[model samples]
Every structure is written in structure tokens, then in C-alpha cells.
Target: MAGVRKGGDLEEVEIDLGDASDPEDLDEGEQPETLWKASSDREGESIHSSSLVDISDTKPLINVRDPRGMNDCLKVTFEDVIAEPVSVRSGDRVWIWSHALFEVSRIWVYRIVTVLLAIPMSILSGILFAVLSCIHIWMISPCIKCILIGTRWLQKLWDVVLEVIVRPLLTSAGRCCGGFNIHLAEE
Candidate 1:
């Protein structure tokens, strides 16, 4: 039993699990009965009872056996590919035959294609990735690092040249030009 407050009023909810304390005590195909009851704080209010759903009574529409999830991409069925509204469904026998044919043909075609191409493509892709990784790690990365080190030395030399030579020359030029003045006239 649990108490819940709703809109300033306290409501009580009760869960009843009948008879069996341990789930293992129930026989195969037997489900423990579960009931939910809700009652308000107001006097003379009736308790509302609701029954819990039994999961064993329901079954999945599609049963896919993909242990490693490898066949997830191929789990589409005839019903998934084709569907009609409930009011416009095809005849029962025709739909059943179509489902059987589609599933059988799809499975066989996938097996045949994989047998022909899977191994060769996997080997080719593996070799290609290995070569690309080696080139990037051994050749391109080292070359880029060498270039970066050389640029750092060149940058220091450039800064020294700018400060020692260019700065003095620009300062002398500015001093020489400081004394000269030109007048602008309109003709």
C-alpha cells in the first residue's frame, strides 16, 4: 500500500499479489494473480480495481534469431515491406503464400551472395586499411613533424632579422623624413 497526494487530497494505492510468495512456486504456464486498487481520502468513495497484464499471453509479431545482431539489417519481413489498411487487406491464403515465398527467397539469396563475396571483400578491405594506416603513421606524420621543427627555427631567425636590421633602418628613415615638410597646393 502507498499513499499519493493529488490536488491536496491523499489517495491510497494497494497492490495485491495472490498466494504465491516465490515465483518458482508457480507451475509452468501459471501466472501469479496481481490486482491494483486505488482509493481516495473522501469517505464513502469506492475503490477502483485494475488487473495487471500477463505478459505470457502476448506474443511478438516478428521472431528474429540474431544472436550477434549480425542479421539485424536483414530482419525485414514480407509484412514490413508490404502492408495494407485493415479495411483493404489481401485474401488470407494469398497473403500467407506471399509471406512464405518472400521469406524463403530472401534467406537463400542472402546466403548465396554472402558466400560469393564476403571473404574476398573482407580480405581486400583489411589490406587496404592496413596500408593506409601505415602510410599515415610512418610517413605523413613524421614528415609533418620535421617540417614543424624546421619552421620553429626559421621563425626565430626571422624575428631576429626584423629586430636587428629592419627596425634600425626604419627608425633612421623616420628620423631623416621627420625634418622635411611638403605643402600641398590646388591648381
Candidate 2:
């Protein structure tokens, strides 16, 4: 039993699971014994029962193998067991049949994704690539080439300036300090 407060009123909900009833039977006016009942705090008020989501008739998203029930394991036989054609069950409770179902689902997903998402994504990528290529060809490439040429010319000018100005200044300073060698042995 779980209780919740709604608008200052306490409501109690009890889950009935003794009958193990299928949820699909609720729509046919045969309410399953296993249900959730909600009672309000007010007296003489009837219990409110909301139908649980019924998924018994629908196929499950995942494959589950029943160990004790039918289709438990694969049987290896030397002779034919049944002459009648096997009916494919909607829900794959069998482990071996699950592989085929998975492959079928994969194929559908691939087709849908290719149709819905992949085509649009590819078109967007193509448009972006074309725009970038146009920018690179018209604007970016010329700017890059001009920057490279300017950088090379500036480097050459810097080397020439350093040789003309700094080397002569250092040589003149050495001469003015009364020669390049000041030996302790001579002193």
C-alpha cells in the first residue's frame, strides 16, 4: 500500500496481485483482480481504480527465454517430431527465434534511419562543405598567401637590419675599450 497527499487530502492506494490477472481483460469489462485501488480521506467516498497499462497482448521489445515453459531449449532429434507447421508466436520467448527477430528489427531501423535522418544529414554536410570550399577558394587562400609573403619579407629585412646596425656597434665598442683581449698574464 502506498499513500499520497493531494490538495491536503491523504489517499491510500493498494495493489492487488493475488489473482495474477492479465491486464487486457480489463477493457472487456472483466476487471482483473490485480488492480491498484486509491481511496480518499473523505468518508463514504468510493475507491478510484485506474487501469494499468495492458501490454500482455503486445510483443515485448526484448527477448526473454522461459526456462520451464514451452520453447525452453532446442531439441536435437533424429526423426521428425511434429508434422504440422509451427505457428510463429508474436512475443519471442524462445532464445533461438530471438536472433531472427533482432535481425528483422535491425533491418527496419536501418531503413527508417536512412530515410529519415541520414538523407537530411548528408544534405546538410554537403551544403556546409560547399560553403566552406567557396570561402577557402575566394577569401582564405589569398589572405594566407599574402600573409606568408609578408612574413618572409619581414624576416629578410630583420636579418639585414641586425647585421648592419648591431654587429658594427659591438665591434666599435670593443675597439673603444682598448682592444678585444684583456689578459691577466699581460697585467
Backbone clashes in model 2, listed as residue pairs: none
The lDDT values for all models are 0.74, 0.64
Query: What is the RMSD of candidate 1?
Result: 17.5
Q: Give the poorly placed runs of model 1, Cα more than 4 Å off.
A: 1-75, 153-187
lDDT of 2 at 122: 92
Q: Which residue pairs show collisions in model 1?
A: none
Q: Against the true structure, candidate 2 has what lDDT? A: 0.64
TM-score per candidate, in order? 0.42, 0.34
Per-residue lDDT for 41-67 in model 2, tens only? 466454443445333332243335454
Model number with the top lDDT = 1
lDDT of 1 by residue, 111-174 (tens): 9999999999999999999999999999999999999897998889999999999999999999
